[model samples]
Target: MTQNERIFLPWWKRVVIVIATVIVFALQIMLFVFAFQVNFDFPFNVWIYWIIEGGSFVLVYHIIHRPILTNYKLTWSILILIFPLPFSLLYYLNQRSLALPKYKQKKIDTILGNYYNPNQIDCTLELDRKDPKAAKLARILRSSTGYPLWKNTKYTFLFDGLLKHEDMLVELKKATRYIFIECFIISDGKLLSELLPILKEKGDAGVEIKIIYDDLGSKATLKKKTILEIAQIKNCTFTNYNPLGLNINPAFNYRDHRKMVIIDGKTAYCGGDNLADEYIHQKKRFGFWRDNCGKYEGEAVQSFIALFIEMWYISTKMVLKLENYLCDYVLERETSYILPFGDGPSNGAEPGYDIFRSLISSADQTLYISTPYLIIDEAMIESIVLAAKSGVDVRILMPGIPDKKVAWYLGRFHYKDILLAGGKIYEYTPGFNHAKNIIVDGRYAFIGTINMDYRSLFLHYECGALILLDNEIYKMKDDFLKACDDSKPITYEDWKKRPWWQKLISYLLYLFAPLF
Candidate 1:
């Protein structure tokens, strides 16, 4: 079926596709096992079983000793122990693929050198003179991700995709040098319908345009013809990062979940909104779709430029001239630091997770978090609980209505703990709160696509901006407070009194939280 047809497929046809996909997936596993068994025919099968069993133990031991997260180790260990042959092989392959090949890494490192300035460390050093605690966090972010702390950057809070859509067009139309757009999902919807013409006009006018999206994430909504048309534009290039094929590997889970729109390296937008109709509320999949995106300027825009180029190199393996894209633009200066960084499973460091933990840990008076998915790990849970226990006014805002019921249920599983620890939990009554934001003591904020979930924190290629002492933070805080007003608070007593079935389901799902 054509891509457009897939989107408009009859319900029964879509159901058939889902069922067939599951069946094929199961068959693939079975065939893999069958092949393994057949390799050791007859009498040797018994010996091979013993060898496999021994190998499984060794793998389990290795997983335990690995310098990975506890949850990941548990998930892999359980799978390897339960299904030795396939899971063992899968684990081995996954470990081998976690890092980029030496040549690719060398090439990317070389590309990155074009953007780094040794003097930028002075930004962090200057921050130390103002707020030592914030400076410490900045140092950690710099050390872990190599993304510098940008000073005097202008930041704007686009409360929803509709607002972001307006700002994006304004910037896109003003593009003189180049435009880079990357999103997790880009569909044949109102957003894309509006964006393509501008891109075409600019591309034909000798302005470079680069676009990237996740193949699996957009396959259901983006048409093949749309992709072809985008590629056909003059001076335009498009990539569906980590394209799907018959090859089954852990790489499938590592999607490019980052979203950004950069114009001339002078301005950029990053946040939870994908290039879809629902994001801008042009087509309502749920109730009013609540989301956010931040428009950025100043030295910080350079970090976003570097981020796009990094992903571009990873996806296309052809590094564009860095000098061609990096533009040093002046900004209407604000006294805030913006650190734009990208994280992924391949990066060997969990900057997203670390930043979340750091933000939570640094909160003194108040901590407010907004995430569509609150399915977080134990470390995150402990940090929030500890903050609340230490007299911090911690409030977590989650979706009242869910796009994914299982994730919603899993999120509720931890509400009781936070509630008991004096942390407030609210469900947005208007609709899904799709924004991934964290505000600390009204002084620091994170506005980006890194959700408080395992997939975003540890698996996907995610990006976001960490803003320190930005005036826009008050705007974000006000929005959060207003959202809290529209939300329904969850009391510990009420949570304990939930339906038995929901409790049972949540508990069952909690066991597999890492995988989700």
Candidate 2:
């Protein structure tokens, strides 16, 4: 069956699309007639300009504005019709030429002013002296700008999605006050079904339950109405981030890719694993889908809760009670220091790329990295090369069988330079590996939605924790070693021996890497 047949569309959406198309067509016709009547000497070049300019405007308008339009439809429609063409043309050209103006930079700086903190270095040194593990973790966290520091926090790092799912279920069952879930892709599969009933029961018992899922991430997997219906039936609130529709903005590419769950403001989970059977290797199609996640308790959980609240408000227009959830719950038992960090497109000052770069720069012993995509920016590429050149052991594992062929090829484009610089590259031969993580110096580790790519760094919403404790770091290191065992190492000689056609394509993809 076709995708539309597989997932039903709302009747209202169909009516709105029809009306929008008519309006757009009418506006174009009116503009053409007015321009002709107003100026009898209108040149052929001017007419061609109108056709090209006006047509481009209509296409973008249809694609962006077609999605969710409730109270802001009229206002948004006016803005799209009046502004998008000229604005988009300018934006597209400037971005293409890498010539963004100073004002844009200032605007970005203003947005990200809160992302950086110079005091983190002192905190890292202090934590290291008091608890070596905390210090190491602090160093990693400090590497990334905008990552907040927490005084008292507990962290549990899971090796794979199996452990993550089991632990998440346990936490969900014990949730007493509230549960907030935000994920880029949430499939209605075994993992979700297991907790659905529990979430429903908790919601019925007066617990506040809220969820946000990205529309594009869940597209063709779950119907919007099905999600809304389930939310209503369970008395839980649900919102979709960046729903795709005609007349939608181009900024739809900036998606909420974070996968996090905060329970009662006491415990939280964040990592690369999504709420799907495939993530846990429960499905037969993808064999051994290895992934990782980190669980946080105490003060660190508060940061995650705050991140969830921010996203919830952005998606649902609901201001959550942050003060109530910010209570410090100190643990008597000794636990490693942890810091929860969040990143996104709006992260003007604390761009996730800078965080990843900082982590790469501070490597002492070894840096073991795992990610699905590797379309890295120039700075990240230089950092990895410099680290390897400086005698810091750097090993990276990418997918052998990628879900996106273009991304896989683009990932290989860096293999030659990485290997030449003394870095080791491995490709997991056993199906797709979707985990995004980095463990530095076998002391500091990070697991989150952010990939070592431009999309995750500057576009998508991402989150992860800077884990300092030795136990978690060791576990992540072991996981990386285990993954290496299942991977085939790509050497400099191997990359140099690539077929002529493959090399040509890889070179082309590399040129367009920034755009991707």
Candidate 3:
């Protein structure tokens, strides 16, 4: 729904926030200068100073109390110990900006809660009869994560953005009730230029259309005038998520890194490909930009709609009823199960990371993964190593052509360790592989927008679909096998001689990974 009034900070609150932020940062600089640059001799025993010494104690207490990643905790501890007041000021600001108010998060959850309520499937007996091990994995998914395994949901695995581009248009032309598009990035490029006309025509046909894009994600490509014009379209609504401003807020780190398209609540698409030229290879950036997109047709699309409604509420504060957009279309039971789920910085559960860990730990025969970036933490490393060491055929495919050099090196940082543990690593020799997919024992297929990096796991909103016992699982496995032919294998011997300087750089970058 479109509205004239926005749920936003009043002008006075905005002024206060800006002024306070400026004063805090200025004081931080002054403290840094005073502590290191200008040493004064007016002190009688520095340890006797109550405020500084007490603040040091307070920093220690904060470090102990803050529920942050261990690596980040250690890194922050080093900074706070070295520069107490400045780092403490930064810490306060970071927390202030990063944490969404509890009431707002609760409101968002309350609106979308029922859709995510746990409901077990009765077909587990059947699943168990066929494959007991996969059934066990299914139980873990439903018990640990709230998403229930659903039947009669159909899935379309679009291997690349080019393929997704062709199929998405076919589905868009059939939208009867409404259209919702949310993306991490929506740049002015070949993709949008081609899709906007279709959206405009649908809007003209009295279809309710809404577009939500990440502010930072599309900042470089989408212009304000473009958003205004889109809003002017008939029955069209638009909002930029976590819109940019001049204020120094901690929220800058938390992003909407999800990409999905929900049409009439009957079909939904989710994957790593953003609406940019490079993603579809319209305007190539790093050779061939290979990515994946998956479309769900049936009841599972409801989860994606709920996710969109949550973000729409968070951004516009508009009241939305889930049932109005939900389609009651049912499909024949072809796939064993399809559970669409989301994860974010919010409390309670992190479905994306939890499921990934569960799959890695639960695999019996083989494990395969493809991702754009591989900036994992300790827990993930342990899982991969343990799985490989246990004789599970573990293999990971990475991009040979780099998009961000630092992220590539960070992935390489784990090469020696993972290779030594019997894990096989391959780099796609053709170009960048932005596809994020994981297959285990050819029984489960996970395809979505999540990348194997710190940002996607810990700092951003992400979503994916887990396909179980589907014929597409075999297709996913076959795709991996085909990719292997075009990929270059990296063995322990190959990693052993890579420049020591590069390893050192990756380690240093990895230390501050949580910040990125």
Give the top-scoring candidate (lDDT). Answer: 1
Model 2 poorest ten-residue lDDT run: 67-76
Clashing pairs in 1: none
Per-residue lDDT of candidate 3, residues 422-497 (tens digit): 9999999889989999899888878998888867876687888877888888888888878878999998888877
* Candidates 1 and 3, the one with greater lDDT: 1
**How many steric overlaps are in each model, in order?**
0, 16, 0
> Could you report the Cα RMSD, in angstroms, for every candidate shown?
9.5, 12.4, 9.2
Strongest candidate by TM-score: 1
Q: What is the lDDT of residue 87 in candidate 3?
A: 74
Q: Which runs in model 3 stand beyond 4 Å of their true positions?
A: 1-53, 65-68, 89-98, 116-145
lDDT of 1 by residue, 1-516 (tens): 122321243455446545644664465457557756776567477566667766776877787676666556666766776678987776755552453666877788788875675558687787888888878877778878988888857899999889989888988999998999999999898888898899999998999888999998999998889888989999998888988888766576588999999999889999999999999888867788999989998778888988898899989998877777777676656468888999985466778888889999999999999999999866678789999999999999999989998899899999988999999999998889999999999988899999998878877899998888788999999999999999999999889998998899998887578767
Q: lDDT per residue, candidate 2, 324-441, as tens digits?
A: 7655566543445567777764443344554577678778779888998898754467789999999999999988777888778778888877888999998888977788888888
Q: What TM-score would each prediction reach against the true structure?
A: 0.89, 0.76, 0.87
TM-score-best of 1 and 2? 1
Task: Order the numbered candidates by lDDT, best leading.
Answer: 1, 3, 2
Ordered from best to worst TM-score, the candidate numbers read 1, 3, 2
